[model samples]
Target: MKYSETINSLIRKGLNEVNHSINGHLPLSIRREILQTINEPCVIGKISISCALKVYPIWNDFFKNDTEIIGLIKQSEKFLLGQINEKELLGNAEHLEVFVQDYNKEDNIMVMFAGMTDVHAAYDVLTSGGMEECVSDEEALQNPDTWDTAFIASLAYNGGAVALDAINHDRNKEFWNWYLTDCIRIAFFNDKLPYPPTTSIVSAKYFSGNNIKEYRTQPNIWKENAECRSRMNDIKGILVKIMDITHWTKSDFYFYHVGTASYTQVFYYKGNELVKFNLDINISMYLSRKVEN
Candidate 1:
């Protein structure tokens, strides 16, 4: 299942509740409440997918290829949620940066998860622990930064990356393009950013050996070293950490886990030791989380 479906299904449920409460037509207040309930998740999902697609047009294209994801555009009703189409979302994000710059134009920007999966999942997780209620709309709106919106987006983005990796491995050039593009999108959206996005290599972990050397010169060193092993393990650790942190959204996260890379591996040689090492362990990440402002 795609992120869009998770959102659409949730909205339908909420709307159904509103519909059942009233006879023919809902009153303005009831309508407003219903719209509010539906809008946040829809907008969150749209912005997340749109922002992600901006970085990874291939991902957007993948969704375009996936009939279920593209189906959102076919809905007759219009809302902030449905407005995001795969193409427009993937369209020149760098170009769109100008508009955002003109709007809030502040370096001290924060991202909030508005999509259905993150918001609802986070709320459920939190509330299940015994909070008086799930995070209030007022609270989410008041401080989007504190909300787990990007955390949810992180799950979706990373989930897609894992799937694409498995389907074609590194051979899927299109998926790599999509992966890198989505990486850029997460960086931009989460960082509250504009671009031509600036990037500095945080770190590079490589995998290399006879098998890998045939692929590249100077050999990618992901495979055979204690250090590489350590780093790769670190990557795994981080992924699990994020997973544990977002356990509340586990079910939602699982939905997008399809078609993304969950872990990665590479071959490396250290001294006499020859081993297959994993680089970043085949997981997708929000670069912003790993970077410092």
Candidate 2:
């Protein structure tokens, strides 16, 4: 289907922003080449179609003509605008079941799964365990809610991977490393913890685990340890300097699990009193690596 000039422009603008944000962290040489590749007319068509497929996976029906693709884009825009609810969004993602069949048959499953992971991760966070306590999509727009950590982390991973695909369809280790660091920072800022809890979050962990024991056994150890200090410094810089999430009013820190192997601790602060704390067990591996080194 031929989208109206206006609709086409809107879609382009929205996609450009996504591309630009993803490229911002890339090195100058790689970023320029990637932007050039993504800006190509043919590639844009594939990207648009891919994004549309994420929303409406009826391959035979949707891929038959441009009109169906246009409709898919419109549906996605509505979800973005908060005009549609989470129920509708998930329903649309379910269409991927059909979409995946063709993707796998064509040997493009890995590329497609990269995008699918984001949707599945978001779905898991919303429905799994205690994540339901996190805020809704509508609430997230106005304020940074605890759930935003999972939602955004999933997106960051997907976005980084997609951006890598655009460049050369190869995994870029540097981009992912930076992206993970940023996700941890953002999660910490939006944590929901109560102020002045009976026990300190960090202290409790120190007594319970060998991992924590290592850090606590040595005074100023994390500071003296280069790798540990670097990670801690990265987190501190993100919490104190980088993030602009001001909507979160709660003072809490809590551990949020993104997946089995990955988790993040979100620490929300109030006037420097350290009111809340979140520690993801996944971070223990990173710390463990540092301890070994």
Candidate 3:
């Protein structure tokens, strides 16, 4: 079951992941790794509420008189306490779904999406807990929701990125480091960030050989995407490829994001090996380094 395919499915999968984690069903980030240890809905509700509050300033600026949205959130909270029925809570979200059509697609789409999904993560996941599939970075980017802390934390980072982009459209690697680290800390670590468990090596016992499963760049799909065609890519083709074939996504071994110099490079870490690929054709021949285990 594709979680992001529909709101109900997303919620069901979210609930499922929290109950029994099989990996890949959650958001791409491992920050929510701890949530799997405890299958508590209230914790998710609390985190969702906090994320919404953190981004409230941005949402408020773009949308005033947000009564319906507020009601949806409040109803979500009520549902968590068993105060309201599922239909009542869902009715509220469904109503705002109509309004979000206008609120979305703006410059602050991430901001709005973060807030919208905030309500979703809180109320929907309380109902079910069964999801399907682990998508790679390419697919993960297209679908970013794990219906729990993994998702909420990821969206907080995404929304902040959009806001920062709106400001100056320039952010260095260090900023990314701080942002992701801080988000993980607040969400799972109780404001404590463990020094990254892995440094620079595919040789660590921490990773699997299949950390990066498949990667390829398809110009045909890029040309079909209006957003892709508009961007002035050197190759005029988008990098659309599967991530790790294992439980890990980029967020699992996500050390930090550093852009390649006039290049598009994708890195995947496996047990004691990190594979770097520069694609121009199919996935294998384009491998920058011979796969070593």
**Tens-digit lDDT track for model 1 on 61-132?**
222233322222222112232444434433323233343234231111111111222223223222221222
TM-score of each: 0.20, 0.24, 0.45
State the weakest 10-residue window (summed lDDT) of model 3. 252-261
Candidate 3 on 99-134: residue-level lDDT in tens? 665655534454556466556544544553223335
Task: Work out how many backbone clashes candidate 2 has.
Answer: 11
Model 2: how far residue 292 lies from native, Å: 42
lDDT of 2 by residue, 19-47 (tens): 45532233322322332333433222232
Those runs of model 3 whose alpha carbons end farther than 4 Å from true positions after fitting are: 1-32, 128-138, 144-293
Candidate 3 TM-score over all chains jointly? 0.45
Residue 222 displacement in candidate 3 (angstroms): 8.2
Model 1 bad stretches (over 4 Å): 1-64, 73-77, 81-149, 158-293
Most accurate candidate by lDDT: 3
Ranking 1 against 2 by TM-score, winner: 2
